[model samples]
Target: MSVVRAGGDGRTEADGTGRAGLRTLLRAADGVRIDVAYRPGPGGREGRGGPDVIVVAHGFTGDLDRPHIRRIAAGFARRAAVVTFTFRGHGRSGGRSTVGDREVLDLAAAVAWARSLGHRRVATVGFSMGGSVVLRHAALHGGGDPDTDAGRTARTRTDAVVSVSGPARWFYRGTAPMRRVHWLVTRPAGRVVGRYGLRTRIHDKDWDPVPLSPVQAVPLIAPTPLLIVHGDRDPYFPLDHPRMLATAGAGAADLWLEQGMGHAEHATTDALVARIGEWLEKRG
Candidate 1:
């Protein structure tokens, strides 16, 4: 069953926009309890919605309540209602982090929850690891999002999708940061650090029969308004990643290689965030 709470602290709290926030513990198709947060925009109704709603997916090791994630949500709230959530195995969510594998189910639960809240023009924006999730989710459920709840279909489709600093292919260890990330998700000792130091519980199993890569999923996102944004100075997956994605998109997606930008949410600037909001607004 889905559990809905008005605020993070049990009492509804304003999102600094004079609008109260809604928190929820949603059940994924796999029965994972995913923690989600939503902040309505100006003139936006609590359960109903404004002109648009953007689902912001945080990167690995990040959660809905992080300061950076909050900042992005606040920026997006300027143009549309914003929804953010913690993937399984992160923050207050249940289950182990499959990194990017089964995390698609986590995102599906969040999108379904947002629709249940009454939003119609819903979009998805992801950072780094989240970037991958949005792409795959849109490809899999863009038409009529397949609700993974065993037997329920929640109409969790996305109107637009944005992937910021996402990797094109899997198992890429070209950069030092990526190498460290590989260790964090691969090694048992690293999993210990991920659990204790990063507060991220990663699954011990590997991707049995590897899932679809970001580039492979890009083509399927056609007609869904795909936007791929990456930093020129990203320390993680480099420029080649986005380039590969753009190639895979084959003119179906928009590519933005921001100058001097780095990887994911930490490197995203307020100006860029505003620009992203503008992009979403334009679509609506």
Candidate 2:
């Protein structure tokens, strides 16, 4: 594994134009080589002393350079250091998708790397499968009173988490169309595509979906700020998922239901960016 610097005072001005640099390396625990992108704070007054760090995880079958990933990273880079990465088997990263189980470790490694660069206050923004990994990481690491239902251990703690179009339940509860879609992607045919190192599906009979359930982990993120953003029209993760997450988290979370939005597209909205920026400012 190798680390490459993308932008910094010496590299580029913090004008939101610096591209995310890629770092190719293997995760210590699983030996999966992953591709990471670092978008450093811009130089001069605007780039000086940014927030802790914001680590971004993309949805299933997504890459580090996905348009949504770049958009979100740029949005946060205006205020903080942003790190985006592809999980193993996706994009330029190594290994096949382990669903969301091992990806948590991948995120943990990224967080550790960010902190090593002197970022103390860390936040995670995850979409779809990436969101599930963040929730699981927080549940295991976020220092909360133990909950037996999830059977999780605290792994890493973050100041805030933004989950967009992430489902609380891995298995479909009410969405028939989504269930059919998930099944098609997780089946053997999906695995065949995955063999070619492509992200195929989130569900597979060989893979246990229980570990990817964010609903079970919501309560554990108590006291840590949570932002649950879901599109009212998202077919994959219906509106109910965020509602249930908010209800479970109570005061610990804020829900943003975007009208006529779907899945990751909500991140591209200007209003959403302003809301998130405002939230970060208030928190800071």
Mark the 10 consecutive residues where model 1 has the least summed lDDT. Answer: 145-154
> Candidate 2's residue-wise lDDT over 1-284, tens digit each?
23345444122223335343445453635677667757775454343432457888888778876776777777777777788888866776777677677788788777766765666677888888888888878776775322222323222456678887887877674777566555546677656665564554233445543474688889988777788888888877777788888888867888888888877744447667657756755665
List lDDT for all candidates, in order. Answer: 0.85, 0.69
How does residue 8 of candidate 2 score in lDDT?
42
Model 1 / residue 69 / CA error / Å: 0.4
Q: Give the TM-score of candidate 1.
A: 0.91
lDDT score, candidate 1, position 98: 93
Q: In the order shown, what is each candidate's alpha-carbon RMSD? A: 4.2, 5.9
Estimate TM-scores for all models: 0.91, 0.80
Best by TM-score: 1
As for candidate 2, its clashing pairs are 1-25, 14-42, 14-43, 140-153, 140-154, 140-155, 141-154, 141-155, 141-156
Best by lDDT: 1
